[model samples]
Each structure stands twice: as C-alpha cells, then as structure tokens.
Target: MTAPRTLLDKLWAAHEILRREDGVSLLWVDRHLVHEGSHHGFAKLAARGLKVAEPDLTFAVVDHYAPTRDRAHITDPQIARMIDTLRTNAKAQGLRIYDLTDPEQGIVHVIGPEQGLTLPGLLVNCGDSHTSTHGAFGALAFGIGATEVAHVLATQTVWQRKPRAMRITVEGTLAPGVSAKDIALGWIAALGTDGAQGHAVEYAGSAIRGLSMEGRMTLCNLSIEGGARFGMIAPDQTTFEYLENRPNAPKGAAWEQACADWAALTSDPDATFEREVKFDARDIAPTVTWGTSPEQALPITARIPDPDTVTPAKADAARAALDYMGLTAGQALEGTPIDQVFIGSCTNGRIEDLRAAAAVLKGRKARVPGLISPGSAQVKAQAEAEGLDQIFTQAGLEWAASGCSMCVGMNGDLVGEGMRCASSTNRNFRGRQGRGARTHLMSPAMVAAAAVTGALTDVRPLMNGRAA
Candidate 1:
C-alpha cells in the first residue's frame, strides 16, 4: 500500500518531468507569469536568437513600473520605456499581455487569479518574489530568477530541487478586525524570518478554511517574507466559487470536472510533513511591523521590542531596525506619527481590501496624505460603481489607477525619502518603499486607521461602529 502523501508531494510529483543525477527535478511549467521586470529574460532571449517555446502558456503584464496616475501622459521616461519594452516584447513573442490599456491590467499576481489563469494543481512561475501568491489557489507556484525565466521561456521547463513540506495550522475563530494579514504577521513574528526556509508551507485548519479567497491570497502572498519557498491552501468551495465563470476558467462541464479534480488536491489525513506549527486564531490581533522586517511585527497594542530581550542574532537585527526606523527600545508602536499612507499592492490591493479601508475612512478625513491604487482596472471600476472612490477622495486620499504603485517604489508613485509611511503592501525591508523611507506594514484597515489618525493606531477602535 502507498503511504499517504502531502499536498506538496502530490503537486511536485504531478509536474516533475524527470530527475537529474544532481537531484534536480525538471518541472513542466504550466503557466509563466511575466511583468515589466521580465525585460532581462526577454533580452536574453533576443541575444540567443530564440523564440518563446510556448507563448500561449506565458502571460505578460505591465506592472511594477506601470504608472498609477496620468496614464495618458507618463511623465517619467524611464517608466514609459519600461512599459513599452514589455509591450514590445510581448508582441514580438505573440504572448497575451495585460497592458496598461487593457481592462484586465493589474499586478500579475492579482490579475492571474481574477482572470482564472491560476488554477488548482498547476505549476505557476513569475519573476517576482510574490509568485507565491498563486499558490493560494492550491497550485504549485514559486518565484524564479531571471535565468530561470529565460529557461522557461525557451524550453517551457525549469530545474529545481524539491523543497521540504511544512504545515502551519490555525484553529479557532478570529476576533473582529483580525485579518489574514494579522495571522500572517503573527506567525512570522513567532517563527522569525527564515523559519520556513527551504520548505513549501501549507496553511490549514479552521481559520484558514474560513478566509475569503482575497484573504487566502494575502496570507500566501506574504509567505515569502517568512522565507518560505511558497504557500498553499487546498481548494474548497471558497476557491471554486471564486474561480467560477472567470474568463480563463474552464467552461460548464469542464468546470465541473476541474472542481472534482481540485476537490481531491488536499493532503491526506495521514500525510506527514517535515515540520508542523499550530496557532490559535484568537491569539492574533491587529498586527503591524514595528521594524524593517515582517518578523519584527507585534500586536498594535504592544511596544517596540528591546533588542536585549531576544536571541543574539535577533537582538542585532532588532537594534539595526530600531536605529533605521528611528524608534526607541520599548517605545509604544501606537501613536508613532506617519508622514503618509498607501493602500494598494498585490498583497492587499483587491476589492475587499479597498472596501475595508473605505469602511474605516467613510466619514473620516485623513490627517496625512495618501494614495489608494486598486489592484486592477476592473477593481477600480467596481470601486467607483460602489462609490468607494468618493469615500476615499472625500476622506482626503488620492484615488489612483490600478498598478503596482507605492509598494514597489519603482513606479512614479514613491514615498519621499526619509518619510514614514503606514503601508498596506507586503514587505517593510529597508528601502523597500524608497531610500530611507520607514515603512510600517499593516492591514488595509490598519493603514486606514493610521491615515485618519496620522499615526500608527489600532484599527479595532475605528471598526467598532462601522459596517465591514
């Protein structure tokens, strides 16, 4: 009899074409997602005089450098060139692209799932670290480097060493205002960065099963921040309902069959993992990054950690982070002033995130300047239809077009140097938003709370009487 298999084991076996003497597995690429940053791979392809092996299986998007404002006239020549470069390359290869003008245009991670290009049991790859975002759909997904991108482009396959399996299970019910972002930050804080290194993580249990697809995506999107190779959640009704009728999703009868296949994609009851961790959902709260790393997070009510309280390695990192962020040891995280706020990114730029922010900012005015970029053009349109745009504008925030905006700092929408920003985007690494820009990562609602108060504030108070 065969031993029970984990979801990771099943996924790896399904896509692995062959194993080499060095123990590297050749994986068949099911979907290759490329953004403006893929120029290096395209350049390599050009220099090698090669064409994309399977253009139909590859998708290109104009993000990262896509402008969030004044699309008709991009002021930055470099940004304009980046967009054009991606467009030119996509056209040259006959690959479908979500261009700036495309209604479906958005962050590659955002649009891939929305358009149904990301499916259960498929292998997805992107040049960006957040390619793990696709794993939320129960697919095997991971980020590839520039060389791997070129390899996939030329041969429709990638060489990789199989990663170990890890399971992170969260049980119990989440408190109000506690989101998947909070759950993610809580786990990273407990385990520290690199906790899941060399492993593909599977999030399971009650709380995970209860999350919306958007929340699942947010959770998986931040997996890389904890040094996970990727993260996944088994496909269930929530997953199926979200994929139903999506443009690229299977049609009618095929959809039923696909769902059936997806239903069997979960890890078996007796499946074993290399490592396991469990958390009670009730323990998680509205959490935020107090320092430069995602693992440097704490509940909003907590104080900044003192370097002396942690291990030598963590103490060193904490000291450096505190110095860079201009915070004192044991300082209260709440009430720390913020210069600006941003609410958008592949991590939290979905419609649900927008609605969460708007719910808090509806009748309130932001004390600091901020920008709200939707995850996709469709999301922007939907927000407008729902009057969420007016709520944001009235609350003294700029409502911009969809793209990877302030999150990347590569696009024109950048946080000014030396500014402190309350951001909903994933990653608070030094210079992630801009050089010397101090970023405090939090949920969209928390960012909204900070925007309204002009400080790092807990979102629960603001959510008390609001309709979510």
Candidate 2:
C-alpha cells in the first residue's frame, strides 16, 4: 500500500488513462485555454484539416493583440485581421470563445480565475507562457508551444513528461513596506536565472500561507522567471474561501464535497522533493530588477553590483546588460532617471495593484510619462466607478483600456529605444519591451513612486515625506 501522495501525483494518477513503460502516457486535459495569439496553432490545424476534439474542454479568448483604445473595430488593420481570424477560426472549429465584447473577456490568465473556470487538481494548458498563473489554484498548469497547442486542440490530451519538484519555504513575517511582488523578486534574485530548470516549485511556510489570493497569483505568475515550469500553493482555507462563493464555484452539496477533496490535496509530511530551499521572509526587503534578466536584481536598499565583483560565469551577461542599460557600477538605484512608468500585465494588473499604485499617486503628479492598464474590462470599469482611474490620470498617468498592453510588443504600444522604464510587468529581458529599452521591475506602488519622482525612487520614504 502506498502512503499519501503529493497533489501533483494524485492529479496525474486520476487523469492517467493509460501508461506505457518508457512511452508517452495517455493523460486527460481538464482545461485548455487559448487567446488570440494562439491563431498560429489554429492556422496549423486548418492546414492539416484537423478539428478540435472536445469543444467543452477548450476555451479561447482575445487579449494579446486586442485593440485597447478603439474597441469599436480594431484600428490597426493587421491586428483587426487577427481578431477576426480568431472569431472565424474558433467558430469553424466549434470551440468556446470568450471574445472581446464578452463580459467575461479579459487576459487569458486573468479571465480564467475570475469566472471560476480554473479549479484545483485540474490539468490546464494554454499557448502563452503565463499559463502557469493557473497553478495558483493548485492545478497542474503550464504553457504549451504552438505545436503542442494544436495537438491539445486536435485531441483533448497533451503528451508530457513529469518534472522534478522543488519545495521553497519562506518562514518568518514580511515587513510592512514589503509585498508579494518583493518576495517574488527576491526569489528570482536568489535563484539566479536558471535555478529551477526542469522543476515545478511548490511554495510553503508561514509567509506564503499569509499571502492573499492575488499575492499567490503574483507568486505563481513569475514561476517561469525562477526557471520553474510552474509553481503552486497547496489549497488552504484562504484558497477555499476565495473560491467558495465565486460565480461558477461548486455550490451547496457540491461545495462540501469539493472542500473534502481539496482538504486531501496537500503534500504529506513524509513526501520527498528533489530539492528544497528556504528563506527567512523577514530578511527580504522591497526588491527591484536592475539588469536584463529577472534574476538580475537587488533590493531597493542595495547598490548596483560592480562587474569586477560579479561571478566569472555571470560577468559577461552582467557586463552586456550593464552596457545596454547604461548603468555605472556601484551607483545607487535610488536616483537613476526614468523616462516612463508602466503598471499593468498579468503579474500586477488587477484591482489591488491599481489601488496600491493609486495610494502612492494620490494627490501627486507624475514627473515622467506613465500608463496603467487594468487586467480586464471588469477591473477597468470598477476602478473608474471607484474613481481610482481619476487618481492615476490626475497624477499624470495615462488611463488605458484593457488588454496585454506594453507587456508584450505584439501590440503597438512600446517604449522608445534606450529609454528607462519603471514597470510592474514581469520579464526584464533586454528586448522584452523593445530593443535597447531598459526595464526596472518593481511593485506597482514603487513604480508610482518612480513616476512621481521621475527616477527609481523608493516608496517606503515617499509613503511618508522622505525619499529613500
């Protein structure tokens, strides 16, 4: 008889239709989500005359290239064509599509949880790298490439190999000025760029347990940055409470059954993981990205690293990033000038993120160019009705419509070459924003502080009267 199994193992066992020794297993996919950018796979399917196997299990959305400003018709001809193509493709394939005009429409990652489409113990897949965001619900979620996307659509299953597990535990309590974003940045910083390669990470400990649902989303959103295929938190009371009364959440008798099952989804005390790392949460400060990679970061209180002091293996990349960012060694990050500030993306584009930014920008004006795009239309409407958009615009930040704006270059929005931007979006790769455009990833509140000061300013000081 086997002892209690990890959540991943339990899900895999339940979904395993057939297992071939050393061969691909015929597993079932519970949910398959795709967005407008997934047209690449649709086109491939069309060329092959293959149809989507199960429309019930597949959901498509429009976000990546959807027009933000003019919703009437996508203003950009190329983008408009893409939007029309998705509608046509999904319709012809008989798949459920949450289109631009759908009340449920939003960034794929944001829309899934909002509608309660993402559930615990499910196997989820999407064409975008950020699909791992669903793992916040304790689902075995991760991204699939264009080919894999087509295959999943053609048959309700994806062939995949299991990955090793890494348990990351953060004990102690977070300081007042710190946030989930800071913890995420700190993990990436300590892990470097490829620390969790070929591994799925499970986060535990008191600090993670204390994080809100949105914070858990933020933590899992950057799992890819930590070099993990995905990250998850075992379903706890907080997770159960958040999903309890949600729109499509299981109800009445179903709810009780779900809670019972979810209660059994945690890792056993004797469960073994491939590797484990622990951190003292109190030791982490507000974190910020300085160089190209997400791992290339330092605390807001620390100075930029000198190339000479960097490890030999990392020196070349560090030098290259420094040259591209035009930063001098040992310079304090506090006073670096910023040309723009962006507060949006799947990472931190929800209502909570907006409120945090607005708190710092209230009654203040931005000295640098700035923009804030909520993750979805519902969030946008709520922010406006609550007058949060007014606070941002009054403070000189542009209030834009929803879509994945500026985070991915597929949209026309972008930063000018060589400009430095304090952004809330994830991924600070060299060409992430645009060629030669420098990115400094920080919390939404900190990004607002940078906008107000027109530099990489610290929010801890600005929250009061001083500027750190």
Pick by lDDT: which candidate is best? 1
Cα lDDT of model 2 by residue, 334-402, tens digit: 889999999988999888888888888889999998878789888888899889999999998899877
Clashing pairs in 2: none
lDDT of each: 0.94, 0.85
Model 1 misplacement above 4 A = none
lDDT of 1: 0.94
Q: Which digits, one per residue and each the tens of the lDDT, describe model 1 over residues 200-298?
A: 999999999999999999999999999997999999999999999999999989998999988999999999999999999989999999899999999
CA RMSD of each candidate after superposition: 0.9, 2.0
